[model samples]
Target: MSQHGVGLRAVMRSAAFLTAGALAVPALAGCGSPDPAGKPLAGPDTAPAARDRIADGGTLRWAVDAVPETLNAFQADADAGTTRVAQAVLPSLYRMGERGRPEINPDYLESAKIVDTEPQQVVLYKLNQQAVWSDGREIGAADFAAQWRALSGRDSAYWTARNAGYERIERIERGASDLEVKVTFKRSYADWKSLFSPLYPKEVMGSPDAFNEGARRALKLTAGPFVLKKVDRADDEVRLARNPRWWGRPAKLSGIVLREVPREKRAAALTAGRVDVAEIDAATAGRLAPHEGTVEVRKSLEPAFTQLALNGAGGPLADERVRRAVARALDRRELARVVLEPLGLPAKPVGSHVALSGQAAYADGSGALGGQDTKEARALLADAGWEPGTVTEKEKKEKKDKDKGEKAAGPKKDDDGSEEADDGTYIVGEDDKARGDDEELAQDGKQHLKQGGAPGAYAPKGTAAPARSAPGPLAKDGKALSLRFVLPSGPGSKTLATVAERIRRMLDRVGIRTEVSKVEEEGYFKDHIASGEYDLALYSWPTSAFPATDARPIYAKPVPAADGSLNVEQNYTRVGTDQVDQLFEQAVGTLDEGESRALLRKADARIWAAAGSLPLYQRPQLVAARSGLANVGAFGFGTPVYEDMGFLKKEPGSPSGKASTSASASRS
Candidate 1:
């Protein structure tokens, strides 16, 4: 097992990736970049600060894409917003450190260490006597046991988001005292510390009904610095107030307002003092240049990569050759270079879907397939029965005639020979709202233009009627083939829009057409991408430290359940194989680092071959913050110390009042 426990939040992030659109994998070790841990202030630029130096009671208006659909992070429909709120209000026994290692939260546990390896793996945990839930219940072994039983994957009735580490746990017992927890595992799990994170109370975990929807909209029990004050979806915010019953170091701020600001408005909100911190897009970062000293654009290498996902459950993408054709048409390398090179980071196509460039297990699995090749792409499409011409010779000629009058209707090429859309900022998220959890998924993944015209398509925003070209997408058996390219129209999506536009042009050259659907950022991941409502979509996946457990579900093959529906798990692409599953299982069971890496590499290769998604590049993690603020920014792998977050008080004679950046606590 990996030294760092790739436990709950680790698996939660992957499962959440299905809902939230983040897919950070397991095991991260790197250099020069902030993606890897252990470097000085490089990983997550939260601007560390001592508890005493921060000004004690300022409300921090934080920005998020949307308020979590569920307060329960373990629910299948929970998103990154759930994780955000959970980090501040719930109990994570071990939080991720700057270097991707899991460290104990002494506020909850006095110590947690492995006690045995033979017979059966066992871990001993000593709980903090003062650790108690918001309802005054002691945080005890009952909570752990209840959580294990609910998420152990043994019961199909629970509807857990994932059951990674729990499935291997044989049992959880109390030892010596009620505060002492003895976790016995059925196997050697390297990422043991990953479990018990964002730990829930027994009241919620003990019952299947409660675990399903009880905490979906509200949390009755919380054990962290902040408590749920309100979930105002109407206002697009999840408000958190300071927890008076908290036993740890007092939170420096009075409360946190997790406000949902569209990516486009986040910059204005920050400038107007409506938000103190926000994850800004590249263009937003650039736009904030004039406010440099006052508003700093903090950059961190996130454990995430943006990719193009192809729905393989039905339609043209269901064929492997067609999927490969789509992959070969796009110039991922050029896209990465054009977007990230200007940001001062070394830009290149993120080689592996399973791991980012900085991780020790990172490998270029897409290499054997070769780079973007138009000739090869056309060949693949033709071979797959997608004829090079349109549905009829007349349609092809009409398209050619229409092309003569227009400028070929493609992305405007910039002066540097690079493609540019109306804007340029990148955000990794879904593009529509969600429906019922158990509703039938969009297996064919199709969406049509239902309104007057595309709301936020290629044309500039506010265009009453944008031209939506409907030229014949190459057809087979007289059926026109086209993919619904879903994109987000929100605060920080200039980059996403640009990428989508370029993809459309590339595919157009090969006689493939796409219908663009610009959707709201709020439910994009939950409703559209994960639900397979779009035949083709672009989104990002955050990395995790435990690959076997965290990354497995993302690529695991969908299997038929007794309910007559395919239990796709987190493989929302609805495509995977037994070979990948076997590799992930072997990696999860192995304690040897070298062996695990080899298995993951093989799995990644198979994933690339499957062509479910094309890894594009490392998503840019740009956090815009007020200079005086501390303990918040592009967190990368580390979770924020919410209680330690606050603004700095000015020094006695310092005119600039900027010593605050340096006031952060020393790196561990």
Candidate 2:
């Protein structure tokens, strides 16, 4: 909450980390570093050289992907946008430090420590004497108690997204004075720093009604270095000004403005002098890095990774052998090649769910999936009672009949004797020849592999395969091995579509049929994926500083609702194994860092054996900033302190100078 860094994409990026609880450990070497496949991890330099002087005052205009649906970061609908906004206006007790560990922020709290762990885990926090809300209310133990009750999962009406570590809290009480707060846990929690992170005021967390309604509008009272000045939904921009009542060090900038910009237009926006900073991908970075203009590209390896989540509760994925077979058939290396290599990036596939490639505790366990072996895949399918020969004959006959039906319903001729499109979707009479080098789309229109456009632009331009060879259609008891795959179809969906198409091809090679479903981007996570509506899905999870505790909700068993329906919060895969849950608790309860790391590694091995998901690769966190911008860059593991961010002041009408805000509008 002490505005560590003000990033428009923080909300979306932080959304991936909301699934689980948090744990703790001493500071260690950072997790991310430059890899051989790419350039040194680039981003804004948080720690600058001594000779560089910090600027006093200026306005910084930045770009964000979308407008936030709500201002509350605790709500179920909160996303990256929410976190970005919250960072400026909320009170974060701790921030991720340079050592990739949680560092207490002195701006909000004077000190915090583990006072006792004998009878119950007790943590004491001393609030700064000057720390008070915009409403002039002192931050106290009541606010802490209110937040714990709202997020503890004790009241179903709260509608919280996660309650993993919070439910273990026993009580919250005031110490000697209103400035002191003591929190007692029912159990010894290692990741206690994750709690009350962006501590909310009692006005917001006091009741279910307040939690629901207060979040719908802009925050009224804030305690951070910056305060929300304006939220222009009409123009897709949020404006913040330095908080006059803030007791901490005065913010260097007079104001900060965040504009909502599309992914494709960010580079252009930075080039056109419309914004000061923009986050670009590797392809965009390559294009802009050579330019010696005012713009500079900063890149860092993100702690997040992408994956194909296979549903374990129902459908073909319900069987563990089928899931393992699917994992074996698809070459993850080939996947990395198709997705990352095109952009001249690394083609290494991530192997663990809990740890990323560059983390200190990282280890690859994907070998348990047996590498890419179509032979092994077929054998697994055969062992699961699915016969390849019989299913192949029936599938071939069905395709033959379907092709005849499609030819019979061919396009109609116009009055000019030109053939018209059959269904008025695609134009006919054009060349239908196959592009041998290009990837083909699936027969069901659900998947595409070619690099046509971003995610949803996968249109098949090549001919279908002449023969169903490798592994014939897998069938058992008159049922074919068919799975449904759902992906987003909005702002950032182009890559997802491409990945989904490639996966569809891999599954097809092992005689598994996949039906691809496209959902709107806004509802992709909340409506489709989180609801468990697909047999398979594509998504990413952000790793937390305390990964062992934070991953509990993601791999934990689904808690049941009062009506008996599955109430899955972050465990979208629906992996309900008691062993995974036990391992998570053991890791979280372990105080020794080495023991915790070992336990987490064991848990990850179990996850791979389950075969519900295959980690693809670590995503690169890239941000483009104009030269002279200091204290604002890509933070690999920690939040950027907003108060510390400023640009080197330039004379009027200079080439690389900061400017004031003008027109504000949303771009698709």
Candidate 3:
């Protein structure tokens, strides 16, 4: 069998094991009351109040960043989190089964069948007989066709790599109540099923041209459990009402209200009972633990990944020795204990492009890249000719003169004879004069000459400033082994900053200089890393249900541009190899799950060995809620289904909703 085939088979075996495990485990039951030890809250035994005025009319407010640019499913740039909220109002043709498998729902589509499958070539989906839109319009194959065209159409700003799968399609055909949608592909693709499902409504989408212009503004028409009642863009709030026309089990809740709240304000809002549920940071989670009964904690697999990217364009880190040395200098265990463990859960270090739960590309490996190896680090640096404490006579003289001048001048005085400057600017003394002159000369072309003056004056022959010494024994060619760690400037950004500081201290112990900087969210992804203007950054990659396809963009090569900006591809490490690319292609193209996974493992090993990136740990999803809430279950992605939840109250009569007969009164 081909390598791709082998890898695909392996992935299937692993997936099978995971599926079995999920089935064997019973659903988690909650205690009757909250636990004082901050353990998970117990489930409520009693049902919520029945249609009472006190419980009937209130908006369950939630928060998020913004509305998705494209509600269309095929569009790549659609924020997954935002789309999930929209999905509550807009239903998909099918929903994921309990085991994370896709199943056709009769509410939207009575049945669906795969008419043809030739890997990536062409696949067809036949819709059900009775699928209809909320506006009382029939949904047919044309809807699916229009939705794909809308996503892949010329004007789509949300275009994604997934679009490439639909490039070969010729046309979609509609047949009476049954809709036949045909997809043609440019090449044979093994994971075609990941792209083919999920049909949208045609009547609401309208014609391709019309949808391209109006999809963003129109919000009322939908076939889901809820319909959009009001949208306040300026205030970042969206109100939803249960869809009376919904064809399935009606939503239990009256409506839902989504509000956008900043990360910092979520904890306070949860405490004040302004919101039913809120996402809390690690530190906030610790602070709220004392009130365990009122707050509930749910842990889920965050699709996000935190890691360090290497710059492999042949600068200071061009050699493997230096790269391995730097990796060895890091104490991964301390990072987890000090940085991640405090947040509530243990940190699992990753060693490659793929996550632990991922397919073969991410097989069992070391917890961290190389583990902690200080001896190996020093040896590598020594091999690179890094000297220990080698200071030239000139440097010694400069240090002595600088110290002497500082003592003689003492402290500076302000105009009011105060000790310090009001503006916080430093004053220079005679000993600092030469250093300032050198800095100015470096900025401009002008230089000082001893006797004769020239257009471009030269420094007096022997009096030239000494070249800056290399940072340590590992550095060569006078290049400083410096790294800049870029982090997000938000509440969650603090975690990254702390990690960066620890790393800085570790590297500094081995003579490496490191700096940390925070960038705004808007420009962070687009300008800092995407523009190729940064050396290194600590960022997260949100996961999708389909890890195989969703992770493709992050490892793709950095496409260069004339203006020096990198493309949207996430290969931040700038390390791309023909072998690795071939394996990735094979893994995606292979039909058998097991074989695909094996190939993925090989690819992961190569990437890890190359030091392209270092995976730190997986973050747990922490959520806070009040004690009165019941039936609240968490999903792997951290989203909670409020409809399945209820509340507890004291019963006025029977304990089990059963009343006793008044036999004595009847006898009298």
Candidate 4:
């Protein structure tokens, strides 16, 4: 099952409720300036300003969904959207480029040089005399040491796979102001520069476990271009003021205010001149198309890819044949056209586990599966001895509906009134066996059948019904098959559901079954996918500034957690092969990018052969800004360049300016 992250439906609903409530309630007599329409206002600007108010001091209200659970760099749990907000307040030593490459920035670090490279090792330097925190403490080697120990030691939740390469560290030597950190891998470790970034202050972090608590309270001690000035967790708002002590050039903007807004309201907020910028969903993108003079849409690439992960640990999905058949049943092209293309994006169908850009150096051949082909799908199922009636005709009907949008009921019942329940509770024309007998046998007397038929009565032996037989052969029912697809409920989830419905229709025409179940947000991650209790799921692989080559852990055999449960993030697919593992190891050890890409390609092919995940599409980070907002630069999933923004001021004779307030509005 391809797993997309949690949908934003709930968040959007909350936003709607808040907006509605705010509109329904009467306003106070005077809170702020009134609009030209003479209405009590929420903020200063009546119309969205073209150029930013050049004032030296004031707040710039920004918006985001949620705040981080921890401030510790090693333990931080933030989504890409949240990370983009944090980047403005926190500095990373190395910044990511458009092609997923990294480069050092002098603003944060005076200089970073590779002092040594030999014998399976490399050493680098952190200039100590150059930088300082807002509290006037010198930023130096101790901060680096503290950061490394904290990330590599315990409490490394924030230490992504990118940090795992640092485990080869041999020693750390400190100079008066500079820190010399040396790393020695058991074998040659590729992408060493990708390993370490800027280190956090040790004086503040103190210990690993205490880092989160300390950072939360010490929000004012950030070393970046901006400093946290106000944090209202209850209201889902945060404000960051310019850091006067920042080592870099002074920020152009005075401060940034981040408010958590729902995805649905983002487009309207931009159009109504309430918010300067926001991320708009694909469905809403169309509404903004006509307002080109007032809006600018930017399309960029992201490391994120949408995929369907198959839980092969148990159930009917245990068979690779079934998994591959399901992959063949999907119509990715249709999904891209009808579902994604409307949003002004393109979809690249891939069978490989690794993304197209990140393929290993050695990989050349295509992935294990190809694009949708119903005939081939039927052949695969036939070879696997799968029969049509067993899975349910709903799958076939759903698949057919994708292309034609025809609403067809599931399999028709015989005139004798022998039809199964839609819930899969009964199998028509089966032997007379009591319900729960197999369950009781499986549990070994843990559950007993009731004696009477009142509430929980078990049928007597003579009256017991036979176990319902599995659905009939697909060959008998036009080769129809039924497959279940699970996804999280949210605004983003609706897109996944549409895609699921499309796939269902396509497969139904090809003799396959597809059913989508939208699971609850909190329970979905823990009880569903992690426990191997799902059929298929849609998800994404969130890449970091330094993406590692540790794909094996996620696709290999399941790894049991410390509490004896399984780690869903790792290997839910239950696919393992010595060849693929070796390729992953080789790619990680290879220093050259070309070599690594080649190896990754090979590993991707092997993963495709295993049919672990069906690649659907890649997700892009989209932000919609009203016209007059300038200097908007997006750095992948990193941070938005707010300092660069300048409002577009309308000319005196312009129609818009005549009806709106003066161009010289002050910053709030």
Candidate 5:
């Protein structure tokens, strides 16, 4: 959940609800609109039924945008698909409950609790003794120790882009027996539960080479209810067969085929009975209402949100003013309306980067800088010496010279579509709906501009500001105000493409020109988004239940490691401040929920000031599944319990799955 869209298939944080070779949609709804009076936070819409009432030995033809690039979630190339694959095959010690809290997964964990805080933090894990990997290796201390070594960041050889809680690990050892593990921490880690959720085997993590590249190729060993059977790349599918050695409840379905079906083809696949379960966009769901008997579309907001990520590593955006200028240029509220209004949900922009609107910790951090104001954007650009109506002959010639023989960036790969990949919100074609810039520029209110330094080596400190009267491309030192906007192209990326196009027009009005680059989905996150090869990108990241744990990596300052490699972890934007890092450190170390929320709020404000990324709105979870499917569909805050998913038993003499009929649940 790169592009967490720096995407979530999130588990992609580590595996997941994500489908990532192409990028993924992670299923994380950090905070939600549920009332405090006991309503389910995720408001899960999957049809619930007792396991005994569910049919067994059925196959779930799942539609995923892409298969995982790597089986290991820790690998640099791993995406949300990596996480989603692990969801069924790997062992996660803890899973997210509907309240957006961690709940122990009894399949692998018996109990996990903090036993000490004095001197050093320590945690004791009680694993289920019955749990064993496919090859008869017990799921115990070896696995935990190996994983800690691989992910703890002590060894630079291991390619772990995200080492959140693992970085704080001091040591991991066997507790009383192989079934129990004792973990000691170098620092206080309030979100320790976040670690080792989708635990890999000792065989996979025992060595750096195996840890780094082995998982990307094959995870021959697994312990979950389902095990790896085949990765049918020719068919764009990852197939899983039920594990015969599973000790917990037998998986209700015999196998799950995660097929790569394009978003546009989703409805047809559903109607044709090709896919039993799939995630769809609001438009797709809207079209399915007339034929609700074929599939029931469920909707909910996920823990993740989509955003406009600014690359502050270099170019014009290195200046916070330009970043904020771009932020103010877009109409977030209207964008939210274009995406979410289709679902009959509230169409307000998500206010905080740290939390969703309905959650208790949620607070609007966007206003600390200012609201949507094209006028302010123009002023900020002008103050930075990129005055409107001032494009010099040199700039004009350069712009013309750069526009020859343009070609698509690369052959397009199938784009992964998850709420995470949707950048979490549609932010789609408000085409004719794009706000008229001429009208917006005429507004009287002028936001206070926090003027920032010019881009490094762009111009001297006191360059004369040109007259800012008319509208035209801004220029500074003979260079026009422009940015490289990288976007993904493929079936699942229509929303992302539309949003990018719309954003292009919005920036155009404020004298900022965006050079659009369309790249293959396979390299979108790895080669572009994560590599910081573009000035601006729009994507989604699944917000975490543990904000301090997850958000820290995404926003932490890039530091130099012993190997001299920039240890960015997950801070793909290449922009961070010590203040932001310190706030997260304080928040993660602070165990009290209220205090942590306060610290995170401070961090969110700093992030807004940094203007590395702008949270747009909650990405709605739109899942369409054949009727009678249970325990899987639009899981909001709730992590799927893979074993419980299946077709409901034909009620006595009910019709088969193809003709199965049911109405959609009440909108959560």
Candidate 6:
């Protein structure tokens, strides 16, 4: 939800419901440059000799970057890892289809339909009679009611991560049968299917105590094809076994073991045959391309985009003109070109923050940021009362003295490492949302490691760096133009550091002094981003199938608690406007898909105009799987059907391959 917005930001709700699938063979070339349209072209040699025939009863040692903080997908800190596990072991009324569209899951629900649209929209869901929890509780209206109540935003104590569409519901009641759930919204919601996904049981969602404590140690029960068997934090692994209570087709593999292999070591794990499948990035994909005959690297555009979030509430970024100036100063295309081009990936500049390229509603609105205009950046700063000025050595010395004085006066941190002024709670945006202190769950939810750039200098081949019109640091009222840029620090952060440096250099040419800071990987989101402790930051938002429902929380107005701390939910940048929120409301309220899309585009234009964040490019999803793995690989805009995944019994071209393919193809 990037707020785990795959933080579950607005669609902290949508991004959390990501679409991924096993990759199809005919692997991409070793040099991963995306084609002209910013898409990757499959290489002739990369294709699987043929689909490896499926064989059952093998343990899949899948590589996950980290162990999930919480198994409960709805929790505030849940990330893609949580969702990956959740999809395999939990039951949702609907699951994402291959096309990134939602399809009703027949295993859980017999049917789900919009029964009424008039006086507040109504959705009726009928549960499958045979569908039951592993604990033997029948899936019914009570589970639906409890989930709705817990997420309705009526109870502050529930501690739910997002309440986008659920907050609009008037009530959830039993329909004609005990198994039927009737949900009526107070306001029309076009993407209601995004709700109750991986629905929780009554026992888990019933009360504040249950909601908070039930998911702490481990899941009590699960209704998916798999059930958690062990969570060995010491060993850094989570193991899942096929659910005995499953009423559907049995899972092909006997069990799944998610091993926490660091991104840097995943390739080694695969090469060593320690792991069966792993999520690979562009660089890693390229590195593994040599072993294409043995490993399949699948590449696709992810429903996410890396961005530069400018803090709008306080700090140097508070001024809209300054925010706009910062947006105009950077060369986003160059950044992409430098970072992704080397990977043989597309460097297409993203225009909309809400919609990625593959979505029907996507539109380029980057023009509002005015594409690398340093002259315009200077002019904007000038119009905002800025003037060129240089900081002298004496002034720097005095500033250091002042900083020392302030440090001496500041409150000391406790021996336990907690800040005296910290109060424990941190700010989370409707879009940027995390914490590492929560132990069983590290507070940091966003996974910055995997999506980080490969190690290299970010100097693109053809693009020239922007030139500065103003010579010295731009200033106004004696305040020098300076920004604190923060990014996660650890392995895989080389690209982010280089990108930040590139931005710093570009902004430097425009007379804006940028101080790049790196937070430890564990405290990156919690201490810096979610807490609003930086002037500017870099991160990505991975969207779910429901963009309209998810985009609002990322850009909606920040509502502060009475105590004055912001209840950021998912909007980490703390940027919003009446028009943006109004358009978001209109887009989600409309039932017409075309009209909804048009409204979203219009809303994106407004978002661009405000310039709190800039969409750089679509984040590439690359994964590497063993040659014999079947029904699993790079799933783009689709969730893998875990039940269908298995390892091949015989290598391709073997004598029995045809019969094995025929038998397993039918199962798929």
- Output the number of the TM-score-best candidate: 6
TM-score each candidate.
0.74, 0.75, 0.69, 0.71, 0.74, 0.77
Task: Report the error of model 1 at residue 384, Å.
Answer: 6.1
Q: Candidate 6, overall lDDT?
A: 0.68
Model 1 / residue 440 / CA error / Å: 34
Quick one: RMSD of model 2? 10.8
Estimate, for each residue in 1-668, the C-alpha lDDT of model 6 and write its tens digit.
42211200111111112111111112122235442112222211212332234566768888885788777666766765677777888787777654455788899989998888897799999889999889888988888889889989899998887677888899989999888989998899878888888788788899998887677558887899999898889988888998999999888788888888866567677776778788765545655778775677765555566788898988667777778778878888877665555445567778677766545556565544467877777776776777887798986897688669855865334333432211111123311233211001011112122446333335588767656344787777778888888876543455565567678878887788876676776678878777889888877766656778877788887887999988765788998777778888898998776677667776776677677888875555567877767777666566678887876666456667444533332221
lDDT string, candidate 5, 1-668, tens digits: 21111110101011121111222211222366443213332466787778997877678888876777788777656655677788889888777766566678888888888898888888999988899999987888888889998888888988886677888888899898888899999999887877887889999999988887777867889999999998888889898889999999989888888888876678778877778888776656755788786688877777667788999988899877788778878888767755666565556777677766544446666655567777777877776668755757886786676654333342233333322223222221111111000000101111112123323424568976655543687878877788998876543555666566668878887888898887776567767876789998876666666778767778889999999878887787888888788888898997666677777877777777667888876777778988778888877777788898887665766655443442121000
List the candidate 1 regions with Cα displacement exceeding 4 Å. 1-42, 50-52, 67-69, 134-138, 153-159, 187-191, 208-221, 229-249, 286-293, 313-322, 373-393, 396-494, 504-535, 560-567, 656-668
| Model 5 worst lDDT window (10 residues) | 434-443
Query: What lDDT is obtained when candidate 1 is compared to the true structure?
Result: 0.71
Better of 1 and 3 by lDDT: 1
Encode model 1's per-residue lDDT on 1-668: one tens digit a residue.
Answer: 11121011211111123221122233333344443212322367788878777887778888887887787777756666788888888888887766655668888989988888788889999999998999898998899999999989999999986677898999999989998999999988866767877799998898888999888888899999999999998998888898999998999888888889876566677776678888765656755788777778877766666778899999999987788778877888767755565566556778787776546566666753456777777777777787744456886687678667545664445343533212232223221242110001111112113223335655666667845442336788878778888876653345666567668888887778887787876667767876788898876665676777787888999999999988987787898988789989898877666678767877887787678988887665678988888878877667688898988876678864465442431100
Clashes of 5: 35
Better of 4 and 5 by TM-score: 5
> How many residue pairs clash per model?
37, 22, 30, 78, 35, 50
Which wins on TM-score, candidate 4 or candidate 6? Answer: 6
Model 3 Cα lDDT, one tens digit per residue, 226-245: 77776667766667777777
What's the CA error at residue 269 for candidate 2, in Å? 3.5
Question: How do the residues 1-668 of candidate 2 rate in per-residue lDDT, one tens digit apiece?
Answer: 11122000111112122122211111222347332112222233443422235556667878876677778777755656678878888898998765345788898889998898888779999999899999888989999999999999989888776665688899999999999999999888877877887888898889898888776567888899999988899998889898989888788777888889865566678777678887665445555666545677665555566778888888777877788778877878867666555444556788678765544345565544457877777777776777864546666797688669757965434333433211100100011110000111122332233434334344366745355556766777887778888876543445566677778888888888886777765566657666788888776666666776666777777778999998765688886566778888998876566667667776776777677777876565667877767767667666878887766645458543233211121111
Model 3, C-alpha of 663: deviation from truth (Å): 35
Measured with C-alpha atoms, the lDDT of residue 33 in candidate 1 is 46
lDDT of 5: 0.70
lDDT accuracy of residue 3 in candidate 1: 19
